[model samples]
Target: MQLLPDSWPPARRWVQVALINLVVAALLGALMRYIFLWEVPGVEYRNIMHAHSHGAMLGWVYLVLFTGYVLLAGPARRVYTYLFWATQLTVVAIFVLFALQGYSASSIAATSLHVLLSYVAVALLWPDLRRRLAGTVALPYLLAGLGSIVLSTLGLWALGIIMSSKPPNMTLFYLAIQFFLHGQLNGWFMFGTLGLVVAYFEKQQLPLNRPRLRQAFILLLCSLLPTYGLAVAWAERHPAIYAVTALGVLLQLLGVVQWLRAVWPALQQLTARLAPLLRGLWAFGIGSLAFKALVHAAVAVPYVAVMSFTVRNFVIGFVHLVTLGATTLTLLALLHGQGLLSLRGRVARLGAWLLLAGFVLTEMLLFLQGLMLWLDWSFIPSYHTVLLLATLLLPAGALLLALRAARAPASTDPGAQPLPQYAAHSPVSANGSADTAANR
Candidate 1:
């Protein structure tokens, strides 16, 4: 919509750009896998890795979150438009600079600038959101998500200090990195997505078990800080750390149980009306989150913790379980639910299937390799080639998604109809236009 300045892209463009960014990041990942199978000249593994991780984190996830906030929060201020573009510029800079120079000064500065931009966004938007969402289910999780974002920066600062030290304390350096990663991925990303889900339920007037929801929220919130111990236990394996991590893991597992109890009834009813693809995505996303909790619980075991951290494959597999399985899948479902993603299009449906298949295959390969290593078995034959082939599906899927989003007109599917509640509460219309009266 022309909700922003004429020079800026519309709200729909924000979503398309975010999807395109995912395509680019996935392509970079495919390239990395390719390099593993056969050495590619002038392509540095570590440097390209920096590009892929940062791009996926900031470009796809963060931007989508930003878009969700802006779209759902109603008519945004001009400042938000400025902030969005500024953040996007910095994300691009980080990807490019990191690809070329790893963590050189330019890349570092760009990364730091993106963080600062987020702070500025939070400062401007948080109070308004709090007031608007007061007494609502989404408020607490959104507040905690923002708070976690700030808290994670402490780890980044600590990391800088650790790295700058003469003959840097390598242990603390890794610990600091884990601290930041845990907070950002587990705290901010997971919590923020939960908040968005609750907000969606509210907007759609879906049934919810409030008491169970509150119980889940409390347990999950309480576990967030202590769970940092679980992330760092690999670096420091004291009994005290394990004890705290065990408690966190237990709390988190209970939280997941409560969460499922609270939402599954409504979710079952909701998905029943959706197309097959959308329905599958919803189930897959929620199921992945539940599985993630189980994975975290397993890490509480001393032997499992030791093996998980010792094996790089395990670490990567776990990260993907969170990022691609839980976070990305849920985000895609949300987008489709909101009419931001057009599954009626053949290309989009094909893309969704391909992406899901790729994620499943690659995850199997990764954890299977980790299991073989844990059991003192030989490597899988042609692991690199098979993994590369699987990885290629991800970029191909993402590329198709991006292309479909770019070419298809926004929400133009005549066969698609929103639920009654959506028409009543939705802030924007189907044609990339904000509803001034409805938003107000």
Candidate 2:
């Protein structure tokens, strides 16, 4: 049996980090429920929510994407391993301190350390990316995503420092949240996921002309416009700015429509082989567009408080649907392409179905929650319980799928790669030279 290489240690380390964060998020969620629903005291629901959100969003989801990106970009070997360990240590220290002693000066110190280390990890990728840019259509998008990460981290660090020195101001808190949300949603998740799609299509040898590439870039920028305006409006408290932001959001919706049109033909071809998974991706994209429309409407009519609900569902619901669901599924499909998942068994198909079911069910719960809030109805206690239960099951199915993939033999095919356009060159021989330029 060929052992997993020590040179690729960072990817494995990231997987471990993701698992740890998943556990931590779950524990924090349970603790919050016990405190609020079971009458335990001294455990702030908001704080627990903060912890859960950070662990899941930054720790699990983003880390997973980071790992996949690293793997696809070629292993970093030593440098990334060091950065990964340092970042993980910082993250764990901060979270542990927060969970045990509550928020404090020391916790803030840890947060600062964590932020610095994370920025370092993100920065380390710059050299690697610089090396990989030749003939890659997705390179620009990935670079832009990384740039956003830097800005987001800086914003977060600034907010943390400010909060440490002053009393809580609602406006500052609101601005901070907006900054963090935009950074994650538009900057990291959308940019990263779409970059990967570009990479995948490239690897599959799908044609990408200059015009299509330009459209993709425009889509990304359009997506960020409303978010940028919203940030400005929140910080400056300008009604006109808010109106303009709503207009920007409408443009973003139009951009998404254009994007879907451009990709429709390619997606149709992929449908025969990737039916269920592609369907999930479509659902996620459609849901996200719906969310953008709702948010625009909510902004247009200030009387409606449903914007929060709409935004939350968009972030939590559709974002995860694409990030955790579609992206992860596509990664698995890539792994399977590399013979990391046995394609010969019914077990793999079963695992896929289970995962798909989990995703659909979870999205249904989110949709129901949004509908309730939109209609000005109170959600029942059971609804929250069901939501949690569904969340738990979804990851459980994902874990099973991952394990099955991990147990399979690695592909020996010289040409087995992610997608055609993503493959920079033909597979390298033992001498690190191109072996053959075979198509997928």
Candidate 3:
């Protein structure tokens, strides 16, 4: 399991490049917040915001998941290398074009290409991953993820039609976003991470309840389609839709709890092996997920659904809660699990802590703002400056992480490794510390 460059391990290069994307996206996000505070602008806010969101979603998240896939199935697949670089090209093109002019001719073309490339990724991955992953219990989760990705494309197509039409359907635009986000958060991100977690447990010869995990997966899949009604409820204003969506939200919550229970024992085992910062990531990431499910289900009430969409603070806070709190942290944990991030040394430790601090502070500010709005405070003073400064921590941490990766030695080692792949299966004590053999 030693790193070798001649072999061109996809884990090293792809993840390195992905971390750069993460830093860039964070910088773009910070810049957006900066303008909101100071209004210093050469570039348009909306256009740059487009770049920020697209870069964060496609550039960082998609690329990281692609790296995780390669890690799980093995890096010997050639199509993966092709998909990796090709998608990077698309991401760069979209980000540049969007920053210059939001959804202008070039940006529109790039967006179209991004959608096509996603399908291309799935097409290239399915045959190869399915083959190598055969007979593995986690294979279904992986394949379901790919399928969800392709299914999510329907939203992009819907968006394109709406945009191209003379009078764009504004309602459909939001609906499309909901479609993409729901499928992605629950389908691609959750399933992919779950598969990797299961694979890690398998490597450790840990016991898992496959039936329970699969039941969770199935419930999520069933609930996803109806959950779109939760978003659509804003426009439709139908009580029946609210009822159905409430049921879907409840099901999603139940499914997650089921999956979490199945993983709890393994997570306790894995937690003791992780660095403290990484352990914090697992705690916050999974904790936010439970919070999200509860909040999302709360929208089963018709008035709450409208408020969630209409209130700027609530909207932004929830979106960041999903992207940064749930997806980003989970992705970081999986990346570390896959051995791409060393997660040792002061540099890595500092970077992780800074990112966590940034996230917590930003969340606090956002939640406070939302509280102000809910309580009829009209607005919160100095909110913009506080948010802008808080946002800076994200990029600062991301940059340090990239630097730490750059400074790390070419090959990883045995005893000095972070979360060694085959650490002894000794039991963990009640205090969450590993026993002697596992620690050594």
Candidate 4:
């Protein structure tokens, strides 16, 4: 098989880097667990956790997805190969430097590199993304979500620099975290999910116009209300601002309901073969809605007893469930679209079932743990271990799915052709490349 492409050289590199980082992160996690089991004291768990988070989120998840998009989405004027490689290099440097030197001068240098590379990547991809939105009803919402990513990245970069400085201001760090959280949770994850759903439904010739418009409105409201309320609450430190934020939270919950209503008709028509993946996405949406509601309830109560467990559930249980579970499922679906995976076969079906089970169990355990903590109940170390072990199923399932995809034959659609064995031989136009290769 042809190996390299003149225009997509970075695509392969990106995948390789992402996989390496994932492996490293997993190894680090294992090491940490072993050390903890050995009763190591002053083990600097927090720093290791930071490394793991950075590696997994930025290095593995984002990089791999972006790389896949580059390879599968085909050539666009904006997305040159060099820029992609530079961005991955910057991300890898950030993780390595952070681990070696802690959050200091090296971290600042690495963060600066990442910021610069991120800007370049965004600039390069903006034109193609804008083209994709040309006549879509949800164009404005899509643009707004893109804007959120830009704003969030800037905030994240600022946070990184601040974190690297000596005698860091804890309050500023907290504010930075808040900004980072909002940007990722609201701007990137939420918008990305909605955009993907709309895109997929439209491609499938399913009814998406109404739901797209409705979701756009809800997301717009969600973007504005909570942002304003959170700013006011932070500035004033008043209970009233909290209440207003809670109102915004309720609005978000309403948006979720509207989303479900919009998609329910299409979901109802899914074949038995597609049910598992569809159900996984549905679970994610439900979890997202529940999380939003819980946030509102927590804000209203504001008492430690009532708020703590709810807050943890929203953050760790709900947020993570939707994020890790839904996002992965969506990514897998997208990959399938690219002809990277087949939804048919015993292995594929078993993998899907295992993944769904793992996600549900892990999320449930996480919520249970949060409740235990809130109630000051006795810790169940064994239960925690089981949860961690259960999480392995997700990756295991993913690996199996990947193997299936790798073994599947290329699409035989009349309009489609097999992907060029070499990147250099691939068609330059997105339509020619994608539609000629896969229906997705």
Candidate 5:
């Protein structure tokens, strides 16, 4: 029996590798949480954190986005395949080096190499993107996301300069780090993922309010530039900066509304037909995006902004809200929708739900802790112990997902088929429900 169907997306290996990285990252995260509750000798919290964050960002999220690009690029390019492996190697180097030595020269070099690799990818892929995506709705979003990827490197460069400064400007260093994080989370991850989603719609011949989508894109792009202020507001404590960030937040709110308008119709028609598990994934992903926007709006309030930056719990919660809640869920849903990872099995469903539950439970605890601290309320009893227990679910779930993908069988679903072959499958029916018989 073939382990994978011949028709599977060319990015199949990429997805498999990415899932393994996700598991590694989740394990690291759980380990960190565990350290908070008990003495784990030889494990430095900061080092583990560096490893976890880098692994999650580059190993899992970045690779998945790269998979999306490959899926959209039509035919496989040798360069893309080379870049994927090269990036994977670099990600492994960074994760291991950081875990062992926490931001030494070697790890920094590896990190820089990853940045350089991305720049090279943009250069190599630009022509194809321009040619293939020119007339599509995904064009602007993908291009903008790529641009953001490049733009974020400026922060890293600044960080290098600051760290090498005579007195080592800690303030500038922190700001630079925040700038990079904001760019990746809000700019590249959000836009790139949405680009992939919109590209799927176009490919499926789904009905979309094109004009509204364009409008939303413009607003979101414009807003994304200034919202860096929100990341820096507490450190700078400037009224003018806060004012600008507030405007950006408001624009983002409006953009989300317009975005919902643009996609809601198609989503309404498609979601009802989605498999139950996939539908739950979609709801969690989409709901997280809306919730993220609302949270940003709240941070526009100076008090809330300051509190968010100061409270460690709030910071962790917000980061996870975007990374795990929005990006990861959406990617998984898209993966399932594409039929790359079948959700029909009990093992798959259990893994997905466990991951979702872990995210929800941890996020609630984090935000609640933040709130209690802000209001001078009592801390949750045995918070660290409870959090560690919840955190364990993430890795457990991730392991199952990786195993499921590893054992996935070949199929003819759109996800399993090459881009050109998708037209051969009549997936949707007259009533807007997916033709389960045909798809399955």
Candidate 6:
């Protein structure tokens, strides 16, 4: 019910547009997957893929962050809306131009414009968000997320510089992409969204192990920069970088363990109160974090490191795990918890389930293919068809979500009953005591 946005033409449109963008991105992805069977005139594979990824990142993820911030934290300065539109325009331009020409002058200009807009976005939004720093763990993570945005620009600039030269250092180009990817995926989207989730708990006065929460935060925050080495390890065979990556892996594992121990119980209790759809979303999202930490640990190994990056299927599968499973679902849960989506609403629930199912299937296909390649097994027959079909559900879900989101009532029913509040000092079941303590 009117949870996010206080902007012109209704804040709800922001959400609707964002979801619509998601639908478009998913469609683009599906098209790419299916292109093998159906050739589209004048379409380039890499160009469309660029649109797919950039659309998801900038159109969906970036816009959703803005929606959540305004929804949960309340209104900020006037410049917020202006920056929001400008950024959206740039994203659209890049997506369209890239489809026309891969890394051409037009797309590059649009990309540079986006990078500039991103800087302004962080600058305008950061001060307003500092209040989020007062007590909850969310603020610091958000700050780090914004910092990642800026740091990513350095990579962007570096890549631009090299691309202009007679012969670009391909390794350097990849390093630039790595910096941007790791930061955007891990730093900005993951941390920022997770922080908001914690803030919601704090707001609800939910039980948590506050000390462990702090530990997890510290461990993860401290590990963030060093973890860049994992991305760097992709290009560099330097022993020192690998060693640093190993350390980052350990820290990440510790952080994740601390986080799970601290919040898992509270989360369980909370999910018990949530609707089935919400629970599924939570399962997809939070569970991905646990699995991702384990995967990161494994990937950190010296033997596995090269394969993780070198294998195209592995790379695609891994990226989707983060984007669809972890980032998108977690943010969706946040939206539902913020009262943006109806837990019992048929359209929303159906859309969420479809998205989850699609993600699962897509990952399955990609990983299966990767495994085949790794073991020297025969390729999966009609692999392209399988991926294409799996990927289609993503957009299908997004379309339903966007349609219903657009039709969503401005607010929840006036007669709707509110769930009983769980006061900070309230007693939970014996099982939850440890978790409640984490909130202290």
Better of 4 and 5 by TM-score: 5
Q: For residue 105, what is the lDDT in candidate 2?
A: 73
Cα displacement (angstroms), candidate 4, residue 185, comes to 1.8
TM-score against native, each model:
0.92, 0.78, 0.89, 0.76, 0.92, 0.89
Residues 262-373 of candidate 6 have per-residue lDDT tens digits of 8777688678766677788888898888777887878678878777877789888988888888888887776666545443567767888899899888988898899889
Ranking by TM-score: 5, 1, 3, 6, 2, 4
Q: List the residue pairs that clash in candidate 2.
A: 202-420, 202-421, 202-422, 203-419, 203-420, 203-421, 203-422, 204-419, 204-420, 205-420
RMSD of each: 3.7, 4.9, 5.0, 5.7, 4.2, 5.9
Of 5 and 6, the candidate ranking higher by TM-score: 5
- The candidate maximizing lDDT is 5
Candidates 3 and 4, the one with greater lDDT: 3
lDDT of 3: 0.74
Give the clash total for candidate 1: 0
Give me the displacement of residue 69 in model 6, in angstroms: 1.9
TM-score of 4: 0.76
lDDT measured at residue 14 in model 3 versus the true structure, 0 to 100: 78
